[model samples]
Target: MDKITIQNLEVYANHGVFPEETALGQKFLVCAELWTEIRTAGRTDDLEYSINYGTVCQEITRFMKEHTSRLIEAVAEQLAEYLLQTLPLLKGITLEIKKPWAPVGLPLDTVSVKIERCWHRAYVAFGSNMGDRRSHIDSGIQVLRDDPAIRVGSISDMIVTEPYGGVEQEDFLNGCLELETLLTPMELLAVLQKAEQKENRERLVHWGPRTLDMDLLFYDDEVLEEPELAVPHPEIPKRRFVLEPLSQIAPYKMHPVLKKRVKELLEELSDRE
Candidate 1:
C-alpha cells in the first residue's frame, strides 16, 4: 500500500475530562496515514485518482471539533470509522490524537492516543427454519443493510436443506451474502447477534430451529477462535446447506485452512454422499 502522511496537524477542540478543559478549548495535534495505492494518482497526475489531503485535513479538523469525548481513544476510534465510511478511496488509516493540554498538575510533554483501522471483507451465512422462512431471511438481510457501516454485497439465492446436528426440525432456508465492513471480527459478531436477537432467535437447542440464524463464515481469510465466536465457521465443509448458497455468490472463494474453493468443497461433500 502506498502512503500519504499528514503530520501533526493542529486543531483547537474541547475534548477532556475536566469541565475547565471544555470551557476553555485547547490545541490538539493530529496525525494521519492514509493507506492506498497511489500509483494511479501519480501516473495520471489527477487529483480525482487520489484522496485529497487538504479535504481530509479539513474533515478531520471539523470532525474533531464537532464531536466531544472525554477520552482521546474514543476520538481516534470514532474518527477512524467516520473517515473510512465517508471516503471511498481510502483503504485504511493510522490516526494519532495528541492532547498536550492535560492538567496533571505536573509538567508533562504530551498525552496521546493512536489507532489503526480499516475496512474488512466478510462473508456471512443466513438461515431460518421456523415459520415464514424466506421472510425471516429477507427481513434479517434488510436489517443488516440498514446499517451504513455495513456494505452488503452479493446475496445468494435461498435454498432449502434438511436439518443438521441430528435434531428433528423443519427444513431450513439457507443463504449467504458478502459484505464490506469497517467492523472488527468481534464487533461484526456482536452486530450479527443483535440482529438475530431482533428476530427472536433462541439457542435452546443446538441447530434445532430458529426464526433467523446468522453465521460469520469468513472475515478476510482470517482464522480466529474465542469462547463465543469462530472464523471460517469451523464446520463449513460439512454443511452443504451453507456451501450451495455460498457457491452462488462466491464459488471460488477459498477456505484458508482447507485451501479449497467453495465449489470444490461442495463437490467433495456431494461425492461422499
Candidate 2:
C-alpha cells in the first residue's frame, strides 16, 4: 500500500496525431506513483529491497522516446503496462502523460491522460470431459502460465467428478487455480476464452461436454454481474466440482456475494447431500 512518487519528469518524444508533432517531436511530462511494500527497504536501508527511482526515471525516458503513439492516452497506457511488466517489484502504477504546446490555436495550458493500473488476484475453475481430458486441462494451465500478464500461483489437484446438469456425458477432470494478473476482468475473460478455443470448446450443448471449460470464479473480492460474466461464479456454492478443488487451494477464501468461506460452503453442500 506504500507508494514512491516521481513527479513531472520531462522527456522529448514523438507522439501525436498531427504530422508536424510526430516529425519534429515535442516535450512531454510524465508522472508516476509506484505502489509497493517499502517496509523492508526502509528497515534494512538496502537499495535492493526497494525500487530504484533513478533507474525507473531512466526507464520512463527510454520508453517514452522509443514508442510512438497517436494520443497521450495510448502513450500512458502502453508506458504503464511496460513499467509494470519490466519492474518485478512494482505492484501497481499511476501514470500521467502531459502534452503541452498544443497545436490547437487557442490559449490552453496542456493536455494529459492519467490512469491507474494494478495487479488483481483471480481464481479460475477448469475442467474437461472429452478427448484426453487431462491433457486439455494441462494445456489450458500452461497457456495461462505462459502469458506475461499472468502469474500462475498455487494450483489444486485435479479431481474426477460425475458430469453436472444430467447431461449423461463422461466424467470430467476438474480443478481450480490461483493467479495474479494485470488484465482487467473482461480482458482476463478473453484470455481464458482463448485458451478454451484452442482446445476447440463448443457451446452447442449447455454444460453437456467440452474439450475444455474455464470459468472465472472470483477476482480480488470484487463482485461483478454482466451479461456474459458473473463474479463468484453464481453457482460456486452449488457446484461440488468447483468447490472441492477451490477449497483445497483456498479453503478460507470468502465468497464476496454469499459471504461464506469456501470450506464453509463445501461443508454446507456436504450436509445437504
Q: Number of clashing residue pairs in every model?
A: 0, 0
Model 2: runs farther than 4 Å from truth? Answer: none
Q: Alpha-carbon error at 157 in model 1, in Å?
A: 1.4
Query: Candidate 1: lDDT of 145?
Result: 89
Candidate 1: give the clashing pairs.
none
**Residue 31 shift from truth in candidate 2, angstroms:** 0.7
- Local distance difference test values of all predictions, in order: 0.92, 0.93
The positional error of residue 126 in candidate 2, measured at the CA in angstroms, is 0.3
TM-score of each: 0.94, 0.97
For 122-235, candidate 1 gives per-residue lDDT tens digits of 999999999899888888888778887899999998888999899998998899999999888898888898888888899898878999999999999999989999898998
Global fold similarity of model 1 (TM-score) = 0.94
Cα lDDT tens digits, model 2, 1-273, are: 999999999999999999999999999998999999999999999989889999999999998899899988889988898888888899999998888877889989988899999889999999999999999998999899889899999999999999999888999999999999999899999999999999999999898999999999999999988998988799999999999999999999999878899999999999999
Q: List the residue pairs that clash in candidate 2.
A: none
